[model samples]
Target: MNLATNVRIVLVEPAGALNVGAIARVMKNMGLYQLVLVNPQCDPLGEEARRMAVHGGEVLEGATRFENLPEALEGCQRAIATTARDRHVPLTLETPKQVLPWCLEGSPTALIFGPEYRGLSNQELNYAQRFLGIPSNPEYPSLNLAQAVAVCVYELYQLSQNNLAVPPQTTEAARLEDIEGYYQHLESTLLKIGYLQPHTATARMAKFRRLYNRASLSHDEVALLRGILRQVEWAIKPQAGDAE
Candidate 1:
């Protein structure tokens, strides 16, 4: 399978030449390309990186560089940011196994890995629609950036090969944009109905967003719920002193 076309591997400020090269080799073994680097602290074409890449040097050479994360993700519709620590962000999160399918869902997607020393910053992670964390020994759970990328990419490669029961290939599969819109609509409706107070709405909405993202609601379902929210808004507007 041509997994390269579906997903891009993004390295943010990666400082280690060896790790970058290792990642390139692993990506080639897994049949993936499309590498992107954001403000790399080390020269990607440096001797160490190229030495480690060996046969995969082509991937390293063809890599695209960006000064910022958003520029690297311009054509990507879905993005998953890998983190070792939980920041309690508003975005939904999943394990590698849980997120691989969505990553392969026919649109340009990216899996972001942060710097070698510290993982992604909360601000950097904000650009992603979701977070993915690898399950590890809690005693010392943090994974090296290149290792984390290798694991996730390998898992995705394995999933692509299995001729398992595939979900219906319909346009209704709730996309990231659809889910985001629904969350907005739901939160607004809840606020209007006094169920979610302005002060506590953020926390409440986070839980609901997690639920809906896990469920992966269909487009029809999203439309139905949004329509209900619209109706509620319309009904409340008149009572709030709006004529007509």
Candidate 2:
């Protein structure tokens, strides 16, 4: 099965050249191509990476670089961040087989992996609508970065072979940027209404983000929500000639 070209493999702050190189090779093996690096700590195209990549030199060389996760995820409609660590946020950690298939259902999807030492921080994980955790022995559950990427990529490749059907969409799915915009607007409006305070906004917003993400909000849905926030802002504004 031919993998979807829109599926991007994003490595966040990856520090190991060998791991990056091996990830490139496996992506090629699984018929995946797109690779995005976010502020990589190591040289992706250096000799060490090239040596490990072997025949996948093109994939490594052709990788796109971004300064941050949000920028890396621009234009993507669906994203699933892989991690072993848990956070205070209320997010379900699904296995790869369950969530990897979601990437094929949308264009410009992302499978995000965090740095080598620590997994994605809560802030980094927020960029994705879903989270994936590969099942392993409880005693030793963490997998190498390349191994995790390979496992997810292989599942994607296998799913493609079976001719997985894209689920019917009732409405156009919201792009990450669109959702991000809504978040900004929502925060602004909430602050104006005293629903969120400057000191606690970040914590409160994380819960709201999880709520909206779980909804898998469509473009129209986000637009409607933003419109409501706009109206709320307008309602609270002091009109001309109003009492001081």
Candidate 3:
């Protein structure tokens, strides 16, 4: 399979039409066709954007716009997000060379990027399985949104085109929407069992997401886990009244 073809370049809350246009162009140049925009703050198809997209105007016009990251990533099986700065928690930040290859293991994957001014939020970053950070001069670490996308796309193009040895993908991975459903079910089940308090459920679930995402759960694996969660929920269902 042409791995690059399966990769989606997801831009979250992009604020500049020029940036979006440039991103569309670079994606085309790198042979990546999927572009998903999440809650774009600027007009993606303005005159300026068209000028910047140049030969890639079609990519810009054909890009899918989503209301949020989850909506954008619905059908994607694996995703890696770009963060300019390291978070307070110890999230593993890999270089594109290392992480891009792993991304090809899953079908309909994504390489997520945040808006230009401020990078991905903690909440947004949680949606991704892994994180990536490009090495740059520490004195001036920030990279333009489009530039960052370009760099990663270039790396992906080289990796997919060079016929390099890639890890075998035995099973088709489960989609993010399915994984997210499982996560919701798990959280509700855990809360029902008093394993998680309402106030702290978010924090605890983030840990669960990280752990399970690392496993790269296949379709059957996710189904088995969801079934287990469902059984737990059924067992906890009150004989009198049940809360949604």
Candidate 4:
């Protein structure tokens, strides 16, 4: 299988048909095909989008749609979300060149972009394992949605052509969906144990996410961790024989 096909370009709540069409055209130009739209604000197949797509119409037509970011990234092992916002907790923001290569290492990966106007919120950003911030002039740092797609697509295309030095995969990384399940299991357990208060759970979970993302846990690795959590829950539960 062409590893290039493993990379998905996911647009979250994109607003402009023209921009979506243009993004399709650029993906075709760079030999990338997977385009995923999450709750798009405009019809990707509308006239405006079609008009901009020109010869790249097929890419636009073949685009898949999802209700949310997590669904769009269901099978992905790694994901990077694009954002210009600064977080209070401070996630390390790397340029596209620095982080984009991580996706090309053979497992399914996603490059996420937020809406045109407001960008991604912290909650939405939580779904990604990494964050991308394209370098631009401080005077006007924002890039048009299509322009941003083009820049990232070009970088990926160049790396793919150069045969980026990716080590052969020996173990499968935990799919984002599985990792998310573990996170949920972990959070619930933590709450039951009084380790996490309701108001503080979200913030504390973000730190856990960062820690796990950095570890790049494999499928079995995550399973083992979750197994431990389940055992902990079992051990802590009140025995029926002991209840007064």
Could you say which candidate leads in lDDT?
4
Give the residue spans of candidate 2 off by over 4 A: 1-4
Q: Judge candidate 3 at residue 143 and give its lDDT.
A: 93
Ten-residue region with minimum lDDT total, candidate 3: 235-244
TM-score of 3: 0.94
Name model 3 segments beyond 4 Å from true: 239-244
Per-residue accuracy of model 2 over 93-129 as CA lDDT, tens digit each: 9998888778776566889999999989998987888
Q: Which stretches of candidate 4 lie over 4 Å from their true place?
A: 1-4
Candidate 1 backbone clash number? 0
Question: Local distance difference test, per candidate?
Answer: 0.82, 0.89, 0.87, 0.91
C-alpha displacement of 86 in model 3, angstroms? 2.7
Of candidate 2, the 10-residue stretch with the lowest lDDT total is: 162-171
Clashing pairs in 3: none
- Order of candidates by TM-score, top first? 4, 2, 3, 1
Which rank order by lDDT, best down to worst?
A: 4, 2, 3, 1
Q: Candidate 4 on 107-216: residue-level lDDT in tens?
A: 89999999999988899888888889999999999999999999999988888888883774789899999999999999999999999999999999999998998888
Clash number for each model = 0, 0, 0, 0
Tens digit per residue, CA lDDT, model 1, 1-244: 3588978999999999999999999999999999999999998999999999999999999999999987888776677889867576655568988877777667667899999888899767755667898999999998877789899988988888883324535654555566566778888889889999999987777677656655656668888889999999988776755565
Off by over 4 Å in 1: 164-169, 172-244
